[model samples]
Target: MQNQESEQVVRHPFGKFTYLLCSILTLLVGTAFMGSSRVSVMLFCLLFSTVLLTAVVSVCHRHKTLGIGLTLVVLMLILNVSSFLTRSYSLTVLHNSLVIIFLAFVFYHILSAVFHDDRVTLDTIIGTVSLYLLAGLLWSYLYSTILLVDPAAFRYDLVNAASEAVTLRNSDLQPLIYLSFVTMATLGYGDIVPVSGPAQTACYLQAVFGQFYFAILVSRLVAMYISAATHKNQQHAQGS
Candidate 1:
């Protein structure tokens, strides 16, 4: 009976955050090294975002939502790819903005699922990791969007270290992608410094948010474990 119960919990759609975590990881790692074509980068993001979004929709148990999400994602993918090929800044900015919306949507669902559950199961721990990845991805999209609007917003390094910036359809959006995660981890490598005020503000905020998330999540897990153990012990004592 205990084994069956554990299996049931594992089988729960909302508890299966491992898939979401893997999908996001693939996106992050793949985009970082997927060669020199921005079209390839956008396509890679398209593939994984579709998969991750579908997973979230399954957890939602709403076929209608999945249908709508699929349609919207696909439509954006086509437009974004075209924008990249045509070198259209407006379309590129629109794509990044839409990506942020989808990331936030998944973040909300996974966070609610992980925190509302009283049990500290393996899936719950995995969901927490998924949330962290989603947070980094969210910030990356925002950074990229800001850079899109104003190239000078970020001080470019791969350039002459001054008065030079990268285009959206070149290689990896590494300047922003790398900086986003490093800032979230609070590493502050200083390789890709944000010269503008908005960029500076985003860096500090993400750093603080990352640290608080780690501290709060660890404490919550520990408290839940203690409570479960104490409740089990009390039941055993009463039986004796």
Candidate 2:
């Protein structure tokens, strides 16, 4: 009975949701780079929103405070759909605001899972990967917001016969998403550069965060694994 309880305690709730998130994020990144049509982008947005809401509800169902917050986020996401369809600039701001809020909630949940006291499980690893992907998504929305306000924030090189340099704008988010991950991973391709001061600052901050997160996560996980193993060995010795 005690062993069963221990196993149950270690079971994380977001494992399946984490897999779904990863798959959707991969598709979104691919679509972004392929120059997908506006309709396709909208479809992806719809799918993403739905999956995000479901994941939040699944992870936060038991916590009263998080559940209430999830309800508000759902309402905001619903409004975002209409605003997205109509292309209302004011509503777009509201939509972006809601997205940032939702991402924050999800980040909190992922951190909870990562720092869980019990033995590290498969779900913990999945949650960690989800957190990394979420970081990219968060930065993508931020860059998108910055570009919306300032059209000349980022400079893009023209790869083809076009002589003029392309400035980043809010029309398509694929490049921004790609740029976010590239910057987060410290892969400076030089194809897309943040020319504005604010943009440069944001990229530098993200790079530092990426390095810090990985270093801390690795050390924490290794420590937890060793502790769990030592405890188990001691238990076996006592039982014998």
Candidate 3:
């Protein structure tokens, strides 16, 4: 029996993060290099928000959250369309805010799943990575919103193509997304610096949060891995 068991290869099942992470990478890489134009940025947000909302909710498989996601997606579509037709800044901001909420919602649910697991599985590890990425995305939305409200919040090379009315057109969304991830990793690449008081505060707070999250998650994963191994050993002894 032992030899037969040793001969069989163990396969790990794909977890919640597997497909969702794939979608995120695909969308981020595919849309990031599309263009720096305002229209392209908005289109990227639309596609990404829809994909994120749809993908995250699939993990819980809850009908209620699924319904809520569908509603948000519809509203997002409507708002995007209206913003284009009427050229309303309020509609645009509202759309971005809703996307932020969707991200927070997903982050909360994923964390809940991580805590609920007793054993350290592949999904749990992937969940941790997903949480980290989701956090960066959430902060990216916040930074974008702040930039929209205050053009001078961040001082970066703004003459990328014809993006003179930077805040109004939201051509800096991609740059802010880059800033978000960089800040979270505490890279401090001064290519784009936050000048305003609010922006500076946000950057520092994100740096701290990112560090705490990494330390805590690593400990949690280690503890769970040990517990799982111990439990397996007990079961083996009992079977003997």
Candidate 4:
């Protein structure tokens, strides 16, 4: 019986390993090498799509909806590659939209897995963290789309090392991604400000969602842990 239980645990799909890989890849693409050359950006896009596709397969492989997930992943891959090659605005928008959808799907599955069982394991903890990071990435894509549509959406106080003001396009992804994370964390560093009404609304919404997600996720995990402990103690007492 113990061996069977261990096997079951070992065979669990979409666990800590997958979530950790996704999170690492997301951080690498989103922050570490952003604003690099075109080749680097293309590489990032390709790797990011692969990560998302891996996640979808991991989560949906056992379900009847795997076909749908696979289809989306393929479409996303194609769009991402095409956007990298062409750099067309329409393709970029479509690619961002697909990314958002894929991330949302993965987030939903991770959340479901985290709270599915009474026990809280390492996988659950890692999955929760992944969800948070995924939310930031999702918002970064949204911000990117907004900037692409309206180059004047955001106002950045670009100051050089010499404290000289410089001009930059809002369409540049590095700054928008930085802004997205800052807004998500409610940092309000004031270096990048959302000047347009739509931009302001989106930033404020992201801040509010970030705070609420943190609070709710923490509370849910704590509750699950406590419940699991209580159940285990009850079983111990009953055995005794």
lDDT scores of the candidates, listed in order: 0.74, 0.75, 0.76, 0.76
- Give the per-residue lDDT digits (tens) of candidate 1, residues 28-79: 7777666656567656767566555755553455777667567667766776
Question: What's the number of clashes in each of the models?
Answer: 0, 0, 0, 0
Expressed as tens digits, the lDDT of each residue in 78-153 for candidate 3 is 8777876687889878977987887887888888888999888888888888788778878887887777788788
Query: Cα RMSD to native, each candidate?
Result: 3.9, 3.7, 4.6, 2.9
- State the lDDT at 225 in candidate 1: 89
TM-score of each: 0.81, 0.82, 0.82, 0.84
Cα deviation of 86, candidate 4, in Å? 2.5
Candidate 2 clash figure, as a count = 0
Clashing pairs in 3: none
Summarize candidate 4's per-residue lDDT along 101-201 as a digit string, tens digits: 87788788878877775677777787777777778778888888787788778787988899988554633556766787789889999988887888888
Best by TM-score: 4
**Cα deviation of 87, candidate 4, in Å:** 2.7
* Residue 172 displacement (Å), model 2: 1.7
Candidate 1 has its poorest 10 consecutive residues by lDDT at 165-174
Give every collision pair in model 2. none
TM-score of 3: 0.82
